[model samples]
Target: MPQTERPVSMIDPSLLLRPEKVYDDKPIEAFRDYSIDDSDPIKERVRRTYYDMHTNQTVDFVKGKMEKWLKFNHFKSTVKDALIKLNELVDESDPDSDLPNIVHAFQTAERIRQEHPDKEWMHLIGLIHDLGKVMAFYDEPQWCVVGDTFPLGCKWGPSIVYGDDSFKDNPDSYNPKYNTENGIYKPKCGLEQLMMSWGHDEYLYRMLVHNKCKFPKDGLYMIRYHSFYPWHAGGDYKHLLIDSDEEIKQAVLEFNKYDLYTKSAEVPDIEALWPYYEGLIEKYMPGVLEW
Candidate 1:
């Protein structure tokens, strides 16, 4: 089925990002090398994390996680409360910012606020986008909750970060049935049917769905697929996208700029910023939500 949904009205959040984008964006004045590769310990850990993620995040693994996580019965908490809990998380998969996940949450949300002030849902999405990562602090390992996500059952696309050699160790890579392009999925099968690697993206997406969040689909799409580097950033997996995804793809791209490039030393004052976000949460997602 071609995912032919009506277009959503949302601002292009990426337009607000300046050309500097992120650190290690080659030619940056900063001497610190932030790009993911050898030598830098931070980037190295990120690489090793990706290697483990690519190795273990098989189709069955993702399905099992869905069975457990999609239940949304882990715990109950309001959106603001969940954000505070997320403060304890540090995404080992991210080579960019090492600050507490709470800081990054405010940073992303604040940037979106600057760009699209009227879109309170967008701001809220940025704030809680990685809230699912709190799963790391609970019981899940960093590998399962963080990193660039790609489809599990299909032939792993080449565009995934560290995909070529890193996935070589993955058991699925050895299986002839799963190694070919389009394995287990037909051409242009909409992403709705695909199983992305189990992580914050899917966790939070399903959480919102289970809670019956009132946010627009575009914001939901951004929350769900922000970590899908293979699809939105690398431009792979197009063969699998249906026509309706064109709208969603644009929203994801717009959301990506703020999510990826907004990391900085500037931290959002939790005290000062709490009120606005609280209202948005109350308006859109109030009360104790199922985890």
Candidate 2:
């Protein structure tokens, strides 16, 4: 059997970043109701992760954790069972969207489909983009499974919702080797050389890369770093990216606009859209993804 066919390990919560405060107090209603003409709720939620990330993340800490956890497989169970488990995790904290996790995923995908029928790859990307959220249901914490992803090789940005204030608690913040803007990296280096804070985005990206999925560059970028709002949206670490990275950045910029703006109160009937997505899935992915 392939290495990715094994079961993912149950992650330790102690290793995950902790939120400084509960986000439930924030006005997430506009985001939940999808009634906002302005305001980016997805960015807000992702920023909340940054708050925790800055304070709790360390170079050795995240590196050790990823080495220990990333090798594990997440595709041991059926996709249906995985989605069911993911729904349970969503239910624990997501009071806004009462819909099942699968339903929420389908809603996002269908919204993209309706807006751009020509972008069939995007429809599929939206459908499974959050599949990494299943990590929470599999015993991962909110920090490890979801959050704003950023490069580990440079200085944590002040604009990064959880920036320097939080990193005071982390040893790497003081480590000269990691405290610099180019910590552990050269100028204009590609993101592939940079390590991202551990989460579902990296997990799913790795799976797609390994499976050789024939997705558009934009779709692949969305999967790899949809949680990386700090660099993409906030312009926080643009200095670290090379020319090739900049081009890829431009491609995904369009994808992010659709992802953040397309949420709605009405849920998409998955049964109605499954055939179209399933065909796309079969076209791009193999009979079974490794994880």
Candidate 3:
């Protein structure tokens, strides 16, 4: 797949995900080297949101949050309607990507289709992977809704984009057990034994698992942990994973090729692509996806 050129921005705050402290406390080199430019408005906005998410989320708070908000009532509308609302929110946040959320989904999915047509299941995964973002419409705060995801029970890595120093304020950071590299997990224990930060990825994974869809397990792992930079991109916390997680890890790595490489300005015609995706959804999912 070809790489998407990072868009330029006229505004002060770039809307891409990063931290305010990242700009203030650390050198620019400390941040991930993406193609995006400093002037990109979306980059700074994304940075502020990341700071909020990392600063506020505590282990126990996220756990209680999953318990309270994990029900299907959160997403009662059709997929199209949900996509429309999600796009509206994105529009308000970053006007540069004036494309609708559905457009983003179609772009990502169509790119996957063009690259690996044989992986039909992967095509569907790309389409709806971020559907759980509909949670934003339910009044969920942006901090809890999106940003980098990491295992809650394990040691938080300094490598995660936000200022790891700020995590000292998090209650879990004090728990002596969770502060270590291994934390609660044994070596190579696998990600299934881990609890990732509560967010859209896990919600969508559970939705697919509950429906028993024909999508590849690897694709599901991609949806579940794509935001898990600590393990995937940083190479931290691998010690906590078990042997079974190796399969899932390898699968996620495969999906990352498409995820990172597929974001391009060239978008597919939604009118033409909708039928294939709709059919795939009906074939795999039940009459109604609970949310």
Q: Pick the candidate with the highest TM-score.
A: 1
Ranking 1 against 3 by lDDT, winner: 1
Q: Candidate 2 lDDT, tens digit per residue, 224-256?
A: 877676666556666677778777677666565
How well does candidate 3 match the true structure in TM-score terms? 0.79
For 1-291, candidate 3 gives per-residue lDDT tens digits of: 012233321111112332333322333333333233348766666666665676667678777877776655554555555555666655222323446667777877887888889888888888877777777767777667666677876678655654465475677777887777777777777777787777778877877676566776687888998767667766667677666776877777666645544443467788887788877777665355566
Better of 1 and 3 by TM-score: 1
* Two-way TM-score contest, 1 vs 2, winner: 1
The lDDT leader among the candidates is 1
lDDT tens digits, residues 1-291, model 1?
A: 111221211111222233554443432222222234476788788878878898888988888888888887788888888888887777887766789898998898999999999898999999999998978866898999987788877787766665467787888887877777887888899877678898999899989988999999998999888888667656677788899977888899898777876675477687998888899898999899999
lDDT (0 to 1) per candidate: 0.77, 0.62, 0.65
Clashing pairs counted in every model: 0, 3, 20
Candidate 1: stretches off by over 4 Å: 1-38
Clashing pairs in 2: 50-162, 51-162, 55-166
Quote the positional error of residue 63 for candidate 2 in Å: 2.4
